[model samples]
Target chain A: DTAVSQTPKYLVTQMGNDKSIKCEQNLGHDTMYWYKQDSKKFLKIMFSYNNKELIINETVPNRFSPKSPDKAHLNLHINSLELGDSAVYFCASSQDRGRMKQYFGPGTRLTVT
Target chain B: AQTVTQSQPEMSVQEAETVTLSCTYDTSENNYYLFWYKQPPSRQMILVIRQEAYKQQNATENRFSVNFQKAAKSFSLKISDSQLGDTAMYFCAFMKREQGAQKLVFGQGTRLTINP
Candidate 1:
């Protein structure tokens, strides 16, 4: 069984279009995170949710919003996507808040044209 | 802010050989954790090993082991009897043991190619 999973492994959208990526974790972890890997392969944390509550919000644009319906699911919605949004999005989950190892899902490759 | 650096961007070694990937970080906090993650062509992040700052002994997982030097703020990963399946982009990461939502600070990454 896959501990972490993301839908639409590959997404190709046009500029100014809105898109949403869904992530679900079956590990029963309390914390979930969204990370963006740019073309240079630089990974940065965008948002984090612990027990369905927002815990960390990085210096991301307002166009991006993360919603957690429950402890097992965290979804990312991008509004008015731009060319710069082209990158790989990874969903991760951990058992606790700190010092715990994070399990990552197969990343979703997003390409905005 | 904590930063992790992997100076060697890429490395190659023949099968049955051994290789070491170096990583260093800068942080004021004494309590923290370090990790090594591997991403192959499939683009799946897989945890290779982990080390705790409080633990003096290095961490080992089968063929993968970490040499953790807290004093120098360095953590290096060594792969023994390297195999082609081990070829991947290896990343060194850090996490502080604090009271908030701890996030991982990853290094630039090292692409290791295990030749047959």
Candidate 2:
């Protein structure tokens, strides 16, 4: 069983379009995070949710928003997608905030044309 | 803002040989955690090893080990008898001990290629 799972491992869309990535964790973790890895392979944290509450918000654009329906799921919605937004997005979860190890999901390769 | 730095962009080693990946971090927080993560071609991040700042003893897991120099703030991963499966992008991360908001600050990552 996958501890953390993300849908649509690959996504291709035109610029200015909107898209969303869904993530779920079966490990019963209280903290979940979203990270973006660019073409250069630079992985950076974009957002984090703890117990269904938004906690860490990196210097990402306002067009990107993270919604947590419950503690087990966190979804990312990107509006007005840009060419620069084409990158691999990864979803991760940790048992408790910061002190515990994080489990990551297979990344979603998003391509914006 | 804490930062992790992996100076080597890429590294290579022959199978059954040994290789060391260097990492350094900058953080004012005295209490923190360091980690080494491996990302294979599948793009799945795997935890290779972890070290706590408070513990002076190095952490070792089978073929994987770490050299943690707290005074120098340098944490490096040493892979003995590297295997082809060890070939991947390795990242060093730092986590603060604070509760409720622990985010990992990652390095640029080192691409390790093991030649069989």
Candidate 3:
């Protein structure tokens, strides 16, 4: 069984289009996170949710929104996608502890044409 | 704000050799955590090792280990008897010990190549 998984491993769309990436974790974790890796392979935190409550929000654009329906699910929705949004988005989950290790899902690579 | 820096953008070594990837971080907090994640061509992020700042002992897992210098704010990953499977992009991450959820600040990553 997969501990963490993401849907639409690869997404290709034109600019001004809206898209969403879904993530789920079977590890029964209370905290979830979203990270983006740009073309330069630089990884940065975008958002974090704990027990379905918003916790950490980085300096990401307002076009990017994260919704956590439950503790096990965290989804990213992008409105008016741009060419610069082409990158890999990773979903991770961990226990509600600062020192706990986070389990990462297979990233979703989004390409904007 | 916390920042992680990986000086070497890329590195290569022969099989059975050893390689060390350097990483340094800047943070005002005394207690934090350091982690090493490996991403191969498949683009799966795998946790290789972790180190807690409060502990003085280094962390070791199988062939992977980390040298953490708290005073100097340095964390380096050393792979012994490197194998072909060790080829991947290694990222150094930092997280502060806080009350609630923690966010990881990752470095630019270092691409490691193991040649046979």
Predicted chain A of candidate 1: TM-score: 0.97
Report per-candidate TM-score of chain A alone: 0.97, 0.96, 0.97
lDDT for model 3 comes to 0.94
What's the distance in Å from true for residue A8, model 3?
Answer: 0.9
Instruction: Please state the CAPRI-style docking class of candidate 2.
Output: medium
Q: Candidate 2, after superposition: displacement of residue A27 in Å?
A: 0.9
i-RMSD per candidate, Å = 1.5, 1.3, 1.1
How high is the DockQ of candidate 3? 0.80
Per-model DockQ:
0.64, 0.71, 0.80
Output the lDDT of residue B57, model 1.
96
Model 1 CA deviation exceeding 4 Å by range: A97-99, B97-100
Model 1: lDDT of residue A11? 100
- How many Å off is the CA of A70 in candidate 2? 0.5
TM-score (C-alpha) between model 2 and the true structure: 0.97
- Candidate 1 C-alpha error for residue A81, in Å: 0.4
* lDDT string, candidate 3, B1-116, tens digits: 99999999999999999999999999999878899999999999999999999999999999999999999999999999999999999999998744468779999999999999
My TM-score estimates for the predictions, one after another, are 0.97, 0.97, 0.98
Q: List the residue pairs that clash in candidate 3.
A: none
